[model samples]
Target: MSIQTGDKIPAVTLKVMGEKGPQDITSEEIFAGKKVVLFAVPGAFTPGCTMTHLPGYIVNADKIKAKGVDTIACISVNDAFVMDAWGKSQNAEELLMLADGNGTFTEALDLVMDGSGFGLGNRSRRYAMIVEDGTVSHLALEPTGAVDVSAAEKILALL
Candidate 1:
């Protein structure tokens, strides 16, 4: 079952690129006592994610923050290196690039989908959520291969 509104986020370790290397960060550390906007993509650098999904957040990050969001994070099932490179390429300095390496977090949320047909293996479905103090307040999931509901503007409107 995928996570839904009113569900507390599960405890899991995600990775992020640090100066030294990849560093582990816990879901608790991210959502605890904070209002956060988290968006997950199928993969890093894929056309929809690279061209539209990620950039929407990068551009509207400030507006989302202005609505009292403590952090705006982007998550993908890629390694930290690729997440870091993609963040830099998109100038996503204001957004947190989190790597769900090994699909731990995605699996925990019950949102993992098989993408082996496209040679991507297991990955996250496209979704976004507003988490308040570790619990989900709003969730937007794309039922198919479109970036309609999970856009930052939609999230901002929800906020």
Candidate 2:
């Protein structure tokens, strides 16, 4: 089953573009003792994600944090290198650009989505959640191709 409210985030190592190179950051390191807004995209630079989803968070990051969020992270089933480039290109310096390159974290959350038809391989489904000290307090899932419920606007209101 997909992750839901009250579920502890799955333990897995994800990558981020560190000062030296791609570095590892575990799920526990991210969610433990922190209130986090974690969102996932089907791919790094897709139309909906780039134009709408990710930008919504980037634009409203500080406002979201003002409501007690400790971190705002965006995850995609792409390599760290690409994630880094995408973050830089989008000016997403305020957000954590997490790279779930192997999709292990997505699989552990049971949120994997097949994108073979679009020339993309396995990917994480579009969703967002509020995680507090390793436990999810709320989850918003997209309906297949929609970005409505999981957009940052909705999440900000919830917070």
Q: For residues 3-86, could you state the per-residue lDDT of candidate 2 as single tens digits?
A: 989999989999999999999999999999999999999998899999999999999999999999999999999999999999
lDDT (Cα, tens digit) per residue for candidate 1, span 54-123 = 9999989889999999999999999999999999999999999999989999999999989999999999
Q: Cα lDDT for residue 59, model 2? A: 94
Candidate 1 residue runs with Cα over 4 Å from true position: none
Per-model C-alpha lDDT, please?
Answer: 0.95, 0.96
Clashing residue pairs for model 2: none
TM-score of each: 0.99, 0.99
- What TM value does model 2 have? 0.99
Q: What is the lDDT of residue 9 in candidate 2?
A: 96
